[model samples]
Every structure is written in C-alpha cells, then in structure tokens.
Target: MIDIQYSAEVRAAKNDGTPIVALESTIITHGMPYPQNIEVAAQVEQDIRDAGAVPATIAVIDGRLRVGLEPDQLKDLGQAQGVAKISRADMAACIASGGTGATTVAATMIAAHFAGIEVFATGGIGGVHRGAETSFDISADLHELAQTPVTVVAAGAKAILDLAKTLEVLETLGVPVIAHGQDEFPAFWSAKSPFATPLRMDTAEQIAKAHATRRALGLPGGQLVANPIPLADQIPSEELDPIIASAQQDAEAHRITGKAVTPYLLQRIYERTEGRSLIANIALVRNNARLAAGIAKALKAQAG
Candidate 1:
C-alpha cells in the first residue's frame, strides 16, 4: 500500500471532488530561505484558492508521501537542512527509507498523479544542461513529461539551460510544448525566447480542453503549458545573455557539474544580478500558480 497522506483541506477537497492543483515542495526547501519561502508558498496556495482551486503541496516526510502539507509542516520543511532533492529515480527510495525530502518537478508530477490530481504549478521545469552534449546530463523532467499524465504549468525551462536543445528533446519525445498566449516559448525569467513553441494556447479553458482531448485520444504523457512571465517583471533576454555566459564560465572554472551545476549557476547569477533573478523567480512562480489554478478549475468544470 502507498503511504500517502492528504492534509485535512486536501482530504475534504478529494471527498467533494473539487479542483485541486499540485504544488512542488522544492521551492520551499531548496529554492529560497525560510521566512520568504513560507510566505511565498502561502501566497501561492492562496492564489490557487482565489482562483477556485485547492493547493496540494506534495512532499515526502518520514516514510509518508504527503499530497498536501499543513501550515506547520510547510514551516518545518522550509527550515529543514540537507533535504534531498528527489526526482523519479529516488522518490520511492526516499519514501521507503523514511527520509524527508522535497519533490522536484518530475517527482511532483508522479506524486500528483498518484493522488488523482491532474494539474501542477511550478516556477520552471528542468531540462538539458548547457554541456549536455558532452556530459549527457539531461533532466528526468523530460522523461517525466513524456510519461506522466499531469499538466504542468511553468514559465518554461530554466533560461540557464540549453533551451533549443531542450525543446528539441521534448519534440522528439512527442511532448507537446504549448506557449500560453504567445508564439515564442518563454525563458524562465523572460517572456520570450528565440525558438518558437510547438503549440500556442491563449486561455486556460483551451489548454484544459487540449489536455482532455489528448487523454480522450489515449495519448501518453502530460502537456507543458509554458506561460510567460509578466513583461514588467522580465529581464530582457539581451541583458541576461551576457550574465548567463559569465555565470556558466564561473561554473566551468570551478568544475561544477551534474545537479550541482544548476544551483551553482543560479546562485552565481542571483549574486551577479544583485538578487534581481530571485525576484523574477518569485514573480514567475506566482504567475504560474495563478494560471495553473485557472487550468485546474477548467479541468474540473470539464469533468462535470
């Protein structure tokens, strides 16, 4: 049997068949500091509620795969140290070992699906790294998208990654990359990238309909809804290009590779940008949460 627990509110929602949007725990554990992380998490949850959906923040704690966390649990998680960054490869092991860990995009999708939740909100999905051709360090997020049936709403793949190659891999895997209200795919902090999106969707209802249609046709995997950050919050790609290059160079100089490379580069960029990147990250995540809530609501309505 699966050792999955739902928070009181999530349990009620499940019993009542209300729309519930799944949130990832890594944003609280690994993405930011304590008070800010808790504050942002609560805000995101409230945003989902405001849009008429319940927020189920997924995580694993002491051998239990929690579909949603209580307020105190969120705070405890935010303050915990050395929490495992779980993905498809280690999620079950982490749960089986009674470990406390945060779920990444890939792991979150898996947990959300297990809980019968179909929509997820996240800041960005991981993808091919810059030196993936040599390192072959592609993210499990790609494969998760190709197999999981959860619709992930995000700004897009992190800009620090090889966006072109990431999109190519998603395409080859037959994962639909749908840009929300735009032709160009979003670059985590920015509204547009050089590459075009494979699909364009302008509304939550339309995106939800597409997801339903795919399932109706017996298609495997989920849809990636690449919502753009608000233009006012975006740092133009032109300005970020050089900063990204410099950060990547520093990572290479220090030989940062594998999972370490992303966090290293992100921190370096955050420092180099004087904390602007973090602000942009928060804004994009909130934006994605709002959109994900809308999609979840639409999906629920469609089901009825």
Candidate 2:
C-alpha cells in the first residue's frame, strides 16, 4: 500500500472519528496567485470547521500523498512555482517521479477515497468544454464520480463548460447530479442555469441518505450535490453568456487547446469581469464547503 501522510489536525480527526471533508489543492496552486489563494483556502477550511466538520486539503508534496496540509505546507504550496496540475492520469506519475503537484477534482477524489474520506468540497468541476465535439475534451472528474464513492459538493460544472452536455454525460455515466434546493441546475457563478436539474435535493440529510442508500445498493459511484452560489455573490448567467462566448472566440483565435484552454478562458473572463468572477468563485467554494460539512456530519450520524 502507498503511504499517506496526515496533518496533525486530520490525524486527530481520524482518531476521534470526527466528520472530515476533503478539498482539492489545485485551487490553491492553480486558482490564483499566492497569498490570496492561501487566504481563500484558509477561509474555506474555516467554513467547513464552522459548519461542524474538519477539512482535509489533499495534495502531493515531494512525491508523497498528503491527505491534509499543515499551515506551513499550504503557504509554501501557494507560493511554489510550476507545480504540476494533476488529475487521475498524471497523479501517480507525479508521485513516482518525486514531483510536487496540486490535485484536481478527480485526483482529489482518488486521494480522499484512499484516506477514507467520504465528502469533498470544491468551487466547480470541469466538464464538457465548449466545442468538445471537435476537441473531444471531457473532464476526468465526471468519470471519477462514476466510480469513486465520495460525495462532491460544488456550485456545479464551471460556467464556461457546456452545461447541458455535461449533465447528459453524467447521466450516461450513471452518476447522480443532485441540485441543492432548486429545480434548476446551477451555473458556476450564477445560481441558476437554463437547464433543469436531473434531481433536486433540499436538505443535507436527504443528500446524505441518498449517499448511504447508494452505498447500501452496492452502487459503484458517488453523488454530486450542485449547491448554488449565494444570490448576493452571483454574476448573472445572462451577463456571463456573452462574456463566455467572447472568451471562447479568443481561445479559438489564439489556438489555446487542452489544459491551457481553461486557464486562458478563465483569465479572459476574469479580465472582462474585472475580478468579479474570482469573488464569485471564492463565495461558491465557501458555500459548498459549508454544505459538504453538513453532509459529512449527516453521514457520520447515519453510520452510527
């Protein structure tokens, strides 16, 4: 078995049987520049704690899988340069090669499962990118959710993705996409999208029960809780629609493909929105963290 390092807090939570929520580290290393990334990470962790669960931010450091990061480690990672943004395909290679890396949603799910964590919180998941018919770009996150039995809470797939296609692909994969408290599927920065949700769940307890029921039935996959961003923080989808289109055009014009596509589009959106996108991102992540914590607690209660 591969060795996993646990931060002192996580070690304590494990020993005490406290509910824990897993977090991805790419948001720290790849989401934004230093200091601010660390600050947002700290805030999200605190939100989980305030909502009555511990947070385990997963990443790979110097080839070792770290299930939870200490304060110093988080700070260093935020400042580190050229860290690999790893997913299912590259995570193992990063570890085996003794390289430091930040985990994406898929990689975080794998690590969370290895560490026996059942819930995760993130801003938004990558999904069917626009123009994927030609690019064949689909996120490994969708596939991970189809097999890994951890509950993931997010606003929804990133707004830049083709939301309808993302939902269709999830249905095909047999993954449950449960929209929290609404009939409409949420856009990443906006509370509602044009598409209706495949499933709607109102309470964390209901979501937790669904998760347990899936496990009881020997289901091989996990559930996605589409928690919407708070109304005050949202950037209306109507406003973002045109911005996204423009960004995509820029991407096509610049020939930004594959992994570069997301960051480039996000930067363009960020520039166009004058930083409102980042603010909304931070808000939604914290909101997801709170809800994920509640689900973790509910699951713990169900187990007992």
Candidate 3:
C-alpha cells in the first residue's frame, strides 16, 4: 500500500468506522479563485459532515497523496500558482516527483480506492467535449469510471460538453449511468436534460443496494449517480444555452484546445454569467456531497 498521511478528522473517522465521503481537490485548484475556492470546499465538506459522514478531501502535496487535508494545506493549495491538475496519467508521477497537484475525478477515484473510501462527491464529471466527433476529446473520467469501483455522485456531465456523445461513450464502456429521482439525466448546473439515462434510482438506499449488487456480481467500475442541482440554484437551460454557445465559439476562435478547453470555457461562462454559474456550481457540489454521505452510510450498513 502507498503511504499516505491522514488528516486528524479522517484518522478518527477510520478508527471509529465512521462513513467517509471522498472529495476531489481540483475544484479548489482549478474550479474557482482563492478564497472563494477554499470557502466552497469547506461548505461541501461540512455538508457531508452535517449528513453524518466524514469528508476525505483528497490531494497530492509535497510528495504525499493525502487522503484528507489539514486546514493550512487546504489554504495553501487554494492559493498555489499553477498546480498541475492531476489525472490518472500523471497522478503517480506527481507523487513520485514530489510535485503538488490537485486531484480531478479520475485521480480522486484512484486515490479514494487506495484509501479504502468507496463513495465520492464532485461537481460534475468531464465528458466528451464539443466537436469530439472530429477532435475525439473524450475525458479520462469516462475510462476511469469503467475501471474503478468507487461510486461517484455528481450533477452529471457539464452542460458545456457533448452530452449525447458522452452518454453514448459511457454506454459503450458499460458503466452504469443512473439518474437520481428523475428519468432524465441531469445537465450539470441545470436540473434536467432532454437526454434519457439508462437507469433511475429515487433513494440513496436503492443506489447503495445496486452498488453492493454490482460488487456481488464481480462487476468492474463504478456507478455514476446523476444528482441534479436543486432547481432554485439552477440556471435554466434556455437561459444558459446561448451563453454556452457563445463561450464555446470564443474558445474555438481563441484556439483553446485539449486540457485548456474546460477551464477556458468555464472562465468565459463565469464572466458572461457574471458569476452566477459559480454559485450554482457550489450548490450542486454540496448537494452531491450530502447525497454521497447518505450512500456511504448505506454502504457501511450493507457491509455490516
């Protein structure tokens, strides 16, 4: 096993068999600006704790793949300049080289599984990018889901991506795409999308049972629990679609490609929306965190 330093809260939680939810660190390093990023991350962690589960916010720093971060560590990471947004490919390399980086969904799953944490909450998983038909810019998150057995709770693929093709590729990879309480798949900041998902489970218990059943059947990979952002917090698709199109056009015109595409699009959307998108994003992440806590508790009960 890789050596990892556990934060006091996570250490105690493990000692007492408390249910723990994993959180990705890229939301701090790449999702938002300094103080706001730290504030948002704390809120999401508190949401899990309020729901009676511990939050293990994963990140790599100073050569350690830490399962949970100390407050000082979180603060420094929040303000650090140019931290590599670590994913499956470079996660190990980052650790080996003693480099600091924030974990993305794919990297978080790799770390969570190593830490023996089964459930994770994130704002949204990356998917096939727009124009992926020609660019073929599918995200590593999809392939990670097909191989890792960690249950991920997210609002869904970000609306900025090619949701149809993302869903199609997920189907091809044999990952379970289960919508929560709704028949329609969620569209990140919005509560629903026109696209249909493969399955829907209305309760956390049901999602937990399905997770256990998959393990029983020796299935590989995890389930994507598509939890929608609360309607009150959502930016309606009708209002946001044109803005998204405009952002994409700007990105294309500016020649932003590959790893740069997502951050570029998100920054543009934030500017265009005048920061409402970030607020909605924080809401969805906290929402996912609460649901993940419930599912983590259920999984513990099932195991016991």
> lDDT by residue for model 1 over 78-103, one digit each (tens)?
99988999999999999889998899
How do the residues 1-304 of candidate 3 rate in per-residue lDDT, one tens digit apiece? 4688999999999999999999999999888888989999998889999999999999999878999998999999999997998999999899999999999999999999998899999999999998988998999999999999999999999999999999999999999999999999999989999999999999999999999999999999999999999999999999999999999999889999998888898999999999999899999999999999999999999889
Predicted structure 1: lDDT: 0.94
The number of clashing residue pairs in each candidate reads: 0, 0, 0
Model 3 lDDT, full chain set: 0.94
User: In angstroms, how far off is 196's CA in candidate 2?
Assistant: 0.8
Q: Which candidate's lDDT is highest?
A: 2
What is candidate 1's CA lDDT for residue 190?
Answer: 86
How do all models score by TM-score? 0.99, 0.99, 0.98
Compose the digit string of candidate 2's lDDT tens values, residues 1-304.
6899999999999999999999999999999988899999999999999999999999999999999899999999999998999999999999999999999999999999999999999999989998899889999999999999999999999999999999999999999999999999999999999899889999999999999999999999898999999999999999999999999999999988988999999999999999999999999999999999999999999999
**Where is model 1 poorest over a 10-residue stretch in terms of lDDT?**
255-264
- Candidate 2's clash total is 0
Q: In model 1, what lDDT does residue 236 have? A: 91
